[model samples]
Target: MGRLALEVADIFRAHGPAWRQSQQGQLSLDQLKVMSAIEQCRSAALGGHVLCCEACAHTEIAYNSCRNRHCPKCQASAAQRWLEARQDDLVPVEYYHVVFTLPAPISAIAYYNKAVIYGLLFDVAAETLRTIAADPQHLGAQIGMTLVLHTWGSALTHHPHVHGIVPGGGLSPDGERWVACKPGFFLPVRVLSRLFRRRFLEEFDKLHCAGQLQFFGDYAALANTTAFADWLAPLRECDWVVYAKRPFAGPAAVLAYLSRYTHRVAISNRRLVAMDARGVTFRWKDYRAKGRTRYKTMTLSADEFMRRFLLHVLPSGFHRIRHYGLLANAGRRANLAKVRAVLHVAPAIDSTARDLEATVGALPPTFVCPKCGAAMIIIETFTGCRAIRAPPKPRGAP
Candidate 1:
C-alpha cells in the first residue's frame, strides 16, 4: 500500500470546504479538473489491477496513478525522462543555476494575469540573458539554457520566480571556437537585475495600454495607467533580485540539480509529518538560516493548506518548462549541430542509447536473500487489512 502524505491528503480533505467558499466564485472547469485529478492520483478511485511477484510467487496489487504532471506523486518518471533527453545536451563544461524573481508588488498582478504576465516574465528574462551575454564586454557568445517557472516559495506562498540552468559558456558570434565566461562569474547580477526590471515594466506598460490587465480587490487602483505606473514606482528604485549560484563542479552535477527542481510541485510527499483535526504538519526549509535551523516544520489548518496549494494552480495549457537561445524547441536541433561543430564536439547519440541509460543507470541490485540467493519479492499491497480482497480465480480459467 502506498502511504499518502498528510500534506497531500490535507489538500484533498480541505477541498470540500474551500470549494464551498472560494472567493473566485465557482471553481473554473480547469481548476476542478486539477483538483479531481490530484485527489484520484494513486488511489483506487481511478481503478487498478494486481501484479503477482514473478520471483517469489507473491501476489500483490498496485493502483495505477493519474499520471498528471501536476501530481507530486507522479513526477519521478517524468523527471527521469526529461533528464534522459537532456543528457546529450550536457557539454563537458560548468553549468550555473540562476534565479529571477518578481518583487511582491508584481506577484499580485501575476496571480490574476497568469498566462500573459508569466509569459512576459519569461520573455524579459531570456532577452536580458541573451542581450547581456552577447555584449562585447560580457562573454560575447550565445548561451543555452532551460528555464522553469515556479510560482510558490518554500512555505507554499504565492511567490513567483524563474529558475534557469545555464551552460557556463557559448559559441562566439563568428561560430568558430567556444568562449567561456569568467570562472565564478556568469554575469553581473546588479546590471542584469536592473535591466530585467526595466524591460519587464516597459512590457507591462504595453500590456496595460492594450487593456489586457485585470484589476480586483487591492489592485483596483492599477486600472488607471498613472496609478499602475505609480504602483511600479517603488520597483524602479529598488534592486530587483537576480541571484547566481556558483557553477556546478561538472556536467554530471547539472543532471543532479535538474532532478530536484525540474518536476517539483509546490511541495513533496516526504515532508509530511501528520494530519488530524488540528491541521496538517509538514517540513519546510528556511533558506535564510544556518544548519538544521534551516529545517523547520509548520502546521496549517486543512483549509489554509488547500488554499495555499491551489493558489499555485497554473493556467490550462501553460508551458511551465521551456528552453531558450540555442536550446529552444523551434530550431534546437539545427542550432545544437552548429554549436557542436564549432566546439568540435561529437554529434549527439540516438534516442535509444539515451533511453537505456535512463532506465538502467544508477540502479541498485534487486533484493535477494543472503542465505539462499533467492530474490525477495513483494507479498501483498493493500490500503489496509480490512480492505476487500480479490476473489480467487475460477478453476481452469487460464
Candidate 2:
C-alpha cells in the first residue's frame, strides 16, 4: 500500500487548532496531549535525524516519531517488538478469539467514566472467563487469557468491547496434565454472556455506590443512585454480548490474529480516501449487513470526524492490552512453565546474540542503500532540534 500524502497527523495539523479553540473548556488534559502528539508527530516540530550512506553518499532526513500508542503511524514497530517478546510464550495449541461487549446503555455511561468503567471491563471480563473455566461443570482448569480493550466500532462509534485471545485449553486441577476443550469449540457463548453480564453489572453497581462513576450531558442525572439504578434496570433485563469465535488453525494464525487487534488504532491512515472542503471520506465495514453492501465508504464533517477519533483516546497510563488468569503478570512465568511441562512441549527457542545479529544481517534493505543497493553506514551523529550540514559534500568536488 502506498503511503498517503495526507495522514491523521495532517488532519490534526490542519484543523486541530480550530477544534481545540472550539472545545477549549471541554477537552481533557489527556485528550489535548493526544491531539498535540498526533499533530506534531514526524513533523519538523519534533525534530529529526539525518542519515548518510557511507558507500553511496545517499542522504535522507527522518523525523522523530511521537511514539504515542494512539498514533496510527507508530504502532507497526511497537507491534513488531511486542511480537518478538511474545513469540516464546506461544504454546503449541489451538487458540480462540472471544469477545465481551458492553451493552449500549453501559457504553453511554462509559464515555464519561472511562477509566473506572474500562478498568472494570477488563477485570470483570477476565474474571468471568476464569470463573466459568474453573468450575467443575465447565473445563475445571485455570486458563490463560490476553484481553485487549477496543472502544470503537466499525463506524468509529463509541462501542466499547473487549477482545480476548484465549488458549483453547488449560492446566488441569491437579496440575498434572493439560485439559483441552473440544477441538473446534470453546466455552458456550450464551453461558459466558450471562455470567459476564451479571459480573459487570454487579461491579458497576458497586462502583456507583462507591461514588466512582461520573456523569455528564444527558446522563447527568445518573450521578444520583436511584436514577443510575433505574437506568441500569433495562440493562439487567437485556442480554449482554459475548461471543466465542471458531478456534484459530494454529500458532502462526494466532500471531496473525494478534497483529490485527493488538496495536490497532480507531482507524488506520490507509482507510482514509480523501479530505476536502466538504468533509473527510473513509472506508468502514457494516457488520450488520451482508454481502457486498457490508463494505462501503463514509464521509463526515471535519469537526465530527475528529470528534469521533478523539472519543477513543484512552485515559493516561490506562492499559488496553492486559494479561490475566495464567497469563497474569504476578505468576505468569511459573504458570506457563507448568503448562509447557504438562504438555511435554519443548522449550521455546530463545534468540542469542549471534542469532539476533544474523536476523538483522539477513535483512538487506534496512542496512543497504535503496538508491544504489550499496551498504550504508552512519558516518556521523546529530542530536534533535538542531540543523546538520550535509556530510561535508563527501569531501570531493562536484
Candidate 3:
C-alpha cells in the first residue's frame, strides 16, 4: 500500500514525549508501551531488511512492523490471517450481528476497572445469549457466537461494548437435528436487552462485594458498599442498549463483515486529515445525525488526541476477540461437524496441504517492486539503531 498522508505514529512521534512527560504517574505501563510501539513502528528504530527486485534490479528499504495488536497499521494482515483460519468455521446459515453496550454510568467506572468490567461484559453477554436461545420459548437450541470488544466511540470517547456475530440458528438439545430461527430474525432485542442488563449487573454486584472493583476521582466514595449498591440501582431500571441487525446475505458476506471489525483499532490512519497549529483534525461519524449530515470533522489538541487514543489501550494479554457457546474454542470443530451433518451440507474443505505449504516457505514474498510488480527479495538485514547502506541502482541506471 502507498504511504498515508498522516498517521497516528506521526502524532505520537511529534508530541508523545512532551505529552507523556506531562502525564507522568497518570499513565499505565501498558499505555506507555503502546505509545512507544506506535512511535517506533516501521521506523529505523526497529530493524529492517533491504529488498531488491529481480526483474529491474530496483531496490528499496523495507522496515519491520511492530506487530503490536493495538497498532492500526499492523492489524490488517492480522485480521486477514485470522479470517483465513475462520473460513472453515462458517456454516451455510444466516448470520446475525448483535451489539451490547454498557450505559454511560457504568462506562465511567469501567476505565478504572477495565479488566474486571470488560471480562464481565464478555461473559455475561455470552451467557445471556446461550440462556435465552436454549429456552424452548425462544429458539430452543444451543447457539454459538463470536464476540469482539470495542472500547471507543466515533469521537474517541470511552464507550465499552461487544459486537457479537452469531449464526441465525443452532443445534437442538439432542444434537440430532438443526434448529433454525424464523426467517431473517435471530432473537428478541428487548428480551436480550433485559436479560443482559440484569445478568451483567448481578455479576458487577458480586465483584463489588468481593472487592474486585476500584474507583477514583469523583467516584471514590463508591468504595463504601452501601454507596456502591445505591449507585447501581438506577442502572437496573434503565434500558441498556442491545440491538441486532438483520441477517447477512450469505457466509461470504459474513466473512466480509468480520474482516472489517475483528481486529479493528480505535481509529484508522485513513481517518486522520491533518495536524497543524490548530491540532489534530480527523473525520468522525455522528450516529445521532441522519443522511449526509452525519459525516463530520473535529480537532483536538495534541495532548488530548494522544490521551483519547491511549484511552483504549487494553490490558496485557487480554483477548479482544472471543468465541463463546457453540463457537467456544474447546469444542468448535466437533460442533461445526454436527451442524453440517444435520444440515446435509458438505463439510468445509480441509486445508492441511495449503497450511503445510505456507509452513514450508511456499508463501508469497512480503514486499514487491513498485515499478515492475515483481517480488522483492531481501538482500540485507540490519538491527535496530543501525544505519542501512544506500540502495543499488536499477538496471541501466548510471
Candidate 4:
C-alpha cells in the first residue's frame, strides 16, 4: 500500500462516528447514497462469485464493489480503462498539463451552485485554451486535450480547479500539416488567466441577472445587483492564476497523470493514519514547499470532515471527464489515424500487455490483503447496507 492509501484508511477509521452523528447536517440524498455505497463497496452485501490464485493456497472470498465513481477502492481500474481507450487519441506530440484554479472568493459562491459553477469552469477553461492556442500569432492549430474537474484541495477544502492534459500541437484547418507549439511553452499563462477570468465572470453575471444564482446565509444580501457587482469588483483587480507545466516526458507519463484523478473522490483510503475516537488524522502535501517533500498531518472533527468530503459530491449526470479540439468526440478516430500517419507510428497492439507496458508506472485495481500476504479478489458486491452472500471457500483450504 502507498502513503495515500494509508491516509485514506486513517480518514475512514477516524471519521466514522462523526459522519454518523451529523447525518442531518447538509447532506443530500445522493450524498447519503454515496456514503452508504462506499461503505459497502466490495463487501458481501451485493452477491459475487469468487476466484483464488492457483499458485498460493492462501484462500479468501472476494467481495464485489459498487463501482460507483465516488468509491476510492474502485476508481483505479476505471481510470486505467479510460486511459487505455484514450491511447488511440494520442497525437504523437508534446503534451502539457495545465491547471486553472478558482480564487477563494469564487469558491464560496461555487459551494452553493456547484453543478452550475463547475460546469462553467470546465467550459470557460476549455474555451480559453482553444481560443488562445488557435490564434495565428500564437499557434493557430486546433489542439486536442482531456479535461478533468477537481473540487477539493489537499486539505479537503472546497477549491475548484481544472486539470487538462493537452497535446502541444494541433491540426491545421487544411489538414495538410500539424502545427507544433513552442518547444518549451504553449500559451502565455497570464493571458490565459485573464481571459478565463473574464469569460467565467461574464457567465456568472448572466446567471445572476437571470436569477439562476441562489443566495443564502451571508450571501443573501449579495443577491442584489449592486451588491453582486460590488462582490465581483475586486476579482477584476486580482490576477487569475492559470499556468502550464513542462510537457510530460511522453505518452506514458500522460497516462499516469490522468489516472490519479480520472475517477477520484474527494479523498482516498490510504491517507488515513489512525481512527480510534480522535477525529480523523491524515497526511496532506503542502505544495508550497520548494523541496516538494514537505507534508503535514491534519485532524478534523468528524462532522467537519464529512462536510468537507461531501462538499465535492457532484451533481448527477454531469460529465467530469471530457475531450475537446482534435480529440473531440466527433472525429477522434480519423484525427488519431492522421496523427499516427504523420509520426510514422504503428497502430496500437491489441493486447493487454501493450497497455500495461504503456502504463506500468500507473496501475488500477491493485488490491492486496493487509492481513495475509495474498491478493484480494472480488466475490460479492453490495450497494448499501444490504448484505450479499460470501463466496464459497476455494477447492481446498484449511
Candidate 5:
C-alpha cells in the first residue's frame, strides 16, 4: 500500500462523508454501499492476510479487497481470470469491433431511467446486429457477438455506448456450413446505423408508453407523450453512430482487447493528478482535437468529481457484459463445436494440452522466494472482519 502514492479509496476516505451528507436523500443505496466498500477496501477496517515465505521467513500482512465491481484496484485479477476462462473459447478467425452509441436526446432521459433504457439498449443493439447479419444480401450467417456496455465518455460524462466483439464468420442458416464474410469487411455501417436507430427508438417508445421512463428538472415536460415524441423525432432525421473497426490481428488480440474493456471501472487511480482544494485534476482524451491537443487534463470540483464518478454506479443486478446469437451463454459451447466442425478445424483442444504447448519454451521460476530462491507455499488464509487488525500468525511464528 505504501508503494502507491494515491488511490480512489483515498478520495472516498477523505471526502466521502461530507459528500454523502450533502446528497443524503438523492444518493441511491447502491452508490452509498459502493462508497463505503471503496473507503474500507484493503485497509485495517477490512482485516487482512498474514503471509510468510517458507524459505526466507519473510512476514507480510495483506489486506482484503472490497471486490466491488466498480473498484478499479480489484479489476486486474478479475480480468485475468475472465480472460483465462475465455482463452479456450477463442476460435481461429478474425474478429471485428463494433460500437453502438445512444443519441444525445436519449442520453438525458437515460440518466433517470437507467435500468429500463440500458436493457433496451442492449436488447435492441443485439437484435439489430443479428437481424442485419442474417440477411441473405449481407453475410447470410448466424454470427455471434460478445457485447459490453460503457456509460462514460473520455471526459467521464454520461455517454452510453455498447462495444461488440463479433466473429468474422458464422454458421449457416441450416447449421450445416460455415459462412465467411468478405476478407476485410463485416457489414455495411450505414445499414447498421439506420436499423439500430429505428429499432432502439421503437423500443424506447414502448417503454415510454408503459410509463417506465421518468423525467425531472429541465426534462420534466418529457413525461408527457407529445413532448417526448417531439424530442425523439430529431433522432430519426440524424444518423445514429454505429460503426465497426478493422478486424483484429488474430485470436489472441481479441482477448487482449476484451481484457482492457470487460472489467473496466469508471476511472483508475493512476489517472488522478491531484485532489487539492482546487478539486481533482485528471487526464482525458478530446476526441474532437488532433495530435498533442487531443490529450488533455480536466479539473472538476471535489463534489462534482464524486458526483460524476457515481453517475456510472449502474442499477443493481444489471448485467453490463452480455452475449448474443451463438455466443449466448446457453448455446456457446455447442455452437463453437458446430462451427469448428463445419470449418474443418481441429476439435476444441483441452485446456491442459493447450497450456503445455503454449508455455513449453517460456521462462520459469518468477515466484521463487526473494531471499533463498526457493518456492513458497500458501499454508493458511483468514477471512475479513469489520474490526479485525492483523491476520493470524503462521502456525508457530513469534
Candidate 6:
C-alpha cells in the first residue's frame, strides 16, 4: 500500500522537540507524553515484525502501533473493537443524535478544570435527559444513552461538547411497555436546552463553592466566589446549545455513525493537507457557511499546530465516552433484554462465544502479500529501535 502523504505523526516527528522546548514549564506531562507517542508511533522506536508471504515470497516490515488513545493512527482498531462490543447493546428502535455544547465562557474555564467540568458536563447532561424524560409532561420514560465527548472543533480549537446517541424512546415507568417517542421526534430541544443550562450552572456553582474549580491566567479573579457568580450570571440567562438531529435510518446507520465519532481524535491524518516553511495546512469546516462553501483550509505555524493538537489531551483516567441510565454497565444486559421483550422482538442472540470466535477468526490477516492475495506469516520479531537482521539461511544452504 502507498504511504500517506501527510500524517500527524509526521508533523510531530518533524517539529515536536523544538516546540516542546519553546513551551517548557507550560506543557503538561500528559501533553508531552502524547507528543512522544505520536512521534514514535509506527516507527522503529516502537519495535516491529517482518512478514513473508508463503506463496509469493513477498516480504514486508510492519511496525508496532503506540496504541495511545490520543494518537490518530491508533484509534481505528480501538473503535472497531468498541463497536463490536456495542452491537448487542443496540435495540431495534431508531436512534437520535443529540449534542450538548458548553458555551464559550465555560469552555474557556474547562481547559484548566477538564476533569471536573467534563465530568459535570456528562453528569448534568445525563441528568437533564433523565429528568425531562421522566417528567409526565415529556416522554415520561427511562431512557438509555451513550455519550461521547469531543473537546475540539474542526479547527482544533477547544470547543467541548458531548454527542449523545439515544434510542428514539424508552421504557415506561411501570416497566411493562416500551415508551416509543413520537415518530421522527425525540424530546423538545428547547426544553432540553433550558434544563441543561440550569442544572449545569447549578452543579458548576456547587463545584466553585466546594473549591473544586481552578482558575488561571485571565480567570484568576474567578477564585473569588462572588466574582465567579457574577461571571456566570449572564450564562444563566443565555441559552445553552442542545439540539437533536433527525433520527438515524436504523441500527446499521447508528453503528456507522458511532464508528466515525466514538474514537475520533481532535483531527485525523486524512485532514492534514500540507506542511512546509509556512506551516501546517489542513481542512476545517466553516459551519456558518452553506453548501460547498463550508469546506475550508487553514494554515497554522508548526508551533501553533502542535499547540492546538495538544490542547485536547484529556486528563489521565478521564472517561470521554460514557453510558447512562439503562445503558449503564452494571445493568445494561438485563435492561436490553427487558426492552427487547417489551418490543415483542426476539432477544439479541447471546453471541458471546460466536462473537469471540468471529472476532478472532473473521478479520483478514494483517499482513498480506502485495503481489498476490495471500496471508503473510511473521518470519522474525525485533524490539526497540534495533534493526531487523536478515533471516537465517536454511540448514542445507548451497
What is the C-alpha local distance difference test score of each model?
0.82, 0.88, 0.94, 0.79, 0.88, 0.93
Per-residue C-alpha lDDT of model 4 across residues 300-392, encoded as one tens digit per residue: 776677778878888878888988877789988788777777667897554454666657666543556545556556544434345569889
How many clashes in candidate 2? 0
Q: Which 10-residue window in model 5 sums to the lowest lDDT?
A: 363-372
Pairs with steric clashes in candidate 2: none
**How high is the lDDT of residue 391 in model 3?**
93
- Report the Cα lDDT for candidate 3: 0.94
- TM-scores of the candidates are 0.86, 0.93, 0.95, 0.84, 0.91, 0.95
Cα error, candidate 1, residue 267 (Å) = 0.6
Q: Which residue pairs does candidate 3 place in steric collision?
A: none
lDDT of 1 by residue, 1-398 (tens): 24764648446845554654664665666666667778776567766555544455554455667777777788998999899888877777788988999999889888889999899989999999998999989889988789999999888999999999998888889777789999888999987898999999899889999999998898898899888888878888988899999999898888998999989998898888887788778899998999989999999987777778877888888998899998998878887888778777899886775676766766644444444445555454454223479899999986
Candidate 3, TM-score vs. the true structure? 0.95
Off by over 4 Å in 2: 351-354, 363-368, 379-398
Cα lDDT tens digits for candidate 3, 1-398:
89999999999999999988889999999999999999999988998999999999999998899999999999999999999999999999899999999999999999999999999999999999999999999999999999999999999999999999999989999999999999988899999999999999988999989999998999999999999989989999999999999899999999999999999999999999999999999999999999999999999998999999999999999998999988999999899999999999998877664578556697676777899999888999998884578999999998
lDDT of 2: 0.88
Clashes of each: 0, 0, 0, 29, 0, 0
- Model 6, residue 350: distance off in Å is 2.2
Runs in model 4 deviating more than 4 A are 1-21, 50-58, 342-398
lDDT of 2 by residue, 130-162 (tens): 998988788888899999999999889999999
Candidate achieving higher TM-score, 1 or 6: 6
Q: Which whole-number lDDT from 0 to 100 does residue 302 have in model 3?
A: 87
* Model 5 alpha-carbon miss at residue 126, Å: 1.0
Stronger candidate by lDDT (3 vs 6)? 3
Candidate 2: C-alpha RMSD to true structure equals 7.8
